[model samples]
Target: MNDIRVSDATQGAAKSAGRKRLLQWLHQIVFVGPATFFFILIVLIPFFLGVYYSFTDWNGISRNINFIGIENYTHILTKDPDFRNAFWFTVRFTVVGILLTNLLGFVLAYVLTKPIRTRNMMRTIFFMPNMIGGLLLGFIWQFIFIRGFAAVGEATGIGLFNLPWLGDRATSFWGIVIVFVWQTAGYLMVIYISSLNNIPKDVLESAEIDGATRMQVIRHIILPLIMPAVTICLFLAISWAFKMFDLNLALTAGGPFKATESVALDIYNEAFTNNRLGLGTAKAVIFFIIVAIITTIQVRATKSREVEM
Candidate 1:
């Protein structure tokens, strides 16, 4: 009798849980139908179309497309100098942007969380640039680089005020990095702030009681505890850096030659400007694969480091 009662109770509970899950999923499907549908239409459909077109010679303006298997990929890899330049430039940008933004963000987050009077205000000011639209922000910075800098140089004796921030290759590269770091650091800071807040006071106190110095505490306790945050910020920075287009377009316009054109800008130029939609689609597909591979590697590396905290 006891065994039968226990079995009956377990079965009833399992059935109840299964029904609850089904009902919850059904509710979500009903409520999120519009968003899911729109995402499928807008994002998924275009993505699939782009993938399909990678293997076909679809000129943006034409209806007739030849089924050219691997020509687009071959052209981009073997024949296209422009694609190579853009790919390398994007690689450089991604590396630099990831390092600077994440480091500066971590520093700012650490400092702001300390007992400071104007820390909140400082966080707001730092984060202000991110709220602005990318295109508008790019144009605005372009103005500063072109008009404002020259005017300031004329008034002030500082040569940096007059130097061509966007004209040269090295300066142009750093110019993009500076702009990106300034805009992105605050967002990362916010993430770090949340991570810091979640670290229990007791843990910090324990570190202090153990005679650990500030740097020691940060290096030993805080960093390991916030590995998850580091992982998230690093991933965000890498992806954002790789996909940077609006700023590159508006600020440098890949100027002083095609020196600053990222892969995204290169793809845009190939597809719309030069009417090589198939090649552009190939680049996009390749770009997607690269991002996926990098993200997977990063996530695995970081997941191993994420502690119980």
Candidate 2:
């Protein structure tokens, strides 16, 4: 009996060791080995290269580089007013875009989730704008703003249709905003619709039984429940607004006189157009830091209010 017990114990130990060895081999084959190699090749290598280049006085074309330390960063922050204005402009656009896009998207989602004949068709149409390339969308809208709208204005003397949408500073800013909101609101509406669908029918029915108005039910029940989607939409809206370049470029081209220059456009011009590679990269790195900070704060703040429902 003692021999039998000893043999069973030995077999159990060996089986456990065999299983661990198989798992270790599987992990190496599946995750640790390829992922580590890919990260070093794709991410780590380029990141270090960018860090090295940001401190140098090398034009992107040259092989030789002179390390100038923080000079690039200093010039970008203090001496570059264009960069400053572009950053501020992006911030303003982002704040307003976040609020309007999410609010409008939520409303659209709420309205469309009810019984309707062409519900799927409407969703596809709404989502179509997002499928279009950003640059192409901007160019299409540019033509509309410049030629189509201008033609309408000339045809009709009414001030509503005749205003110079992209010719003036104030109007141009709003023109860009309008294009952004129109292109983006529909995409966000789909996200809100998914969240809205998850709300329990019983909960809504109880609220209705208590004689809660539609507005009250939405304000009290639906909005609080869909806070997760709100977080996602708000983050996306801010990032899109801040990084808006192609649209600004194709639509207004930062004209009639640099009035619509955004941070991304300014950096692009500085880096590629002006050959100020170091300064542009410095601006880019700083811009990245600012975005990271803003997204972190926004996500954290919104996450605090999110309910399990």
Candidate 3:
């Protein structure tokens, strides 16, 4: 009788364990399954299809596609002067944009962290430009550059405002830079503020007690503690500057002899305007690889400098 009872107890325990395992599996499927399915459908499938289409000669509207191997890639690397020019222009713009935006953002964040009377109001004012969409902001600045500056020039008799802001190569390049920095710096400033706020007050107090100068404290203490924020800000700045498209379109439209054409804009023109889907996808693949490599290197380099608090 005892053996019979023991067998019945073991069976019950095993059944309970099996039901618990089944419930956990069902819970995971309920929560995670939908996201996984959508990600594969939307992102993964399109990406693989793009990779396959890059080797074929398919116009945007064509149903028939002929495989062309590496011809598009070779043509881009060797013969496409426009793509080359756009690539170089993008490289230069990214470098300048990243540097200026980060520097200005850090400065704004540092100043706002002080015991100022109007710091909150000042932050809101600075960050207001970022709230506007890039396309709208570009249009607003276009008017400012063309009409507003001309009016200011007339009133103030300033040659700087009178110069054709978007009509020339150098001025147009700097024109975009000015607008980009103005729009993005405030966003980065918010990130820096969060990081700066998290820093221990005791550490700063100790540094001050050690007779360290303001600059010295910043260099030796504040910067190291905030390296993670620096890394994040650099990544965001790099991505923004490199992938600049809408603003480039609305502002210059790759105009003034295609001097400010970015890689993203060039890809758009190739696929949609030029009706060469395969070639454009090839360019896109290259652009993705370049951006991935650059951001990876930047992250690794900055992460290495991160100090443990």
| Candidate with maximal lDDT | 3
lDDT tens digits, residue span 51-153, model 1: 9999998888898988899988998889989888988998988898999898899899989999999999999998899898778889998888889989999
lDDT of 3 at 268: 96
Top-down lDDT ranking: 3, 1, 2
Alpha-carbon TM-score of each model against the true structure: 0.90, 0.91, 0.95
lDDT value for model 3: 0.95
Q: Candidate 2: deviation at residue 187, Å?
A: 1.5
Q: Would you list the C-alpha lDDT of every candidate in the order shown? A: 0.91, 0.87, 0.95
Candidate 2 residue lDDT tens string, 132-192: 8889999898789878887888888667667788888888888888889888999999999
Model 3 Cα lDDT, one tens digit per residue, 49-163:
8988889889979789999999999989999999999999999999999999999999999999999999999999999999999999999999999999999999999999999
Clashes of 1: 0
lDDT of predicted model 1? 0.91
Report the number of the highest-TM-score candidate.
3
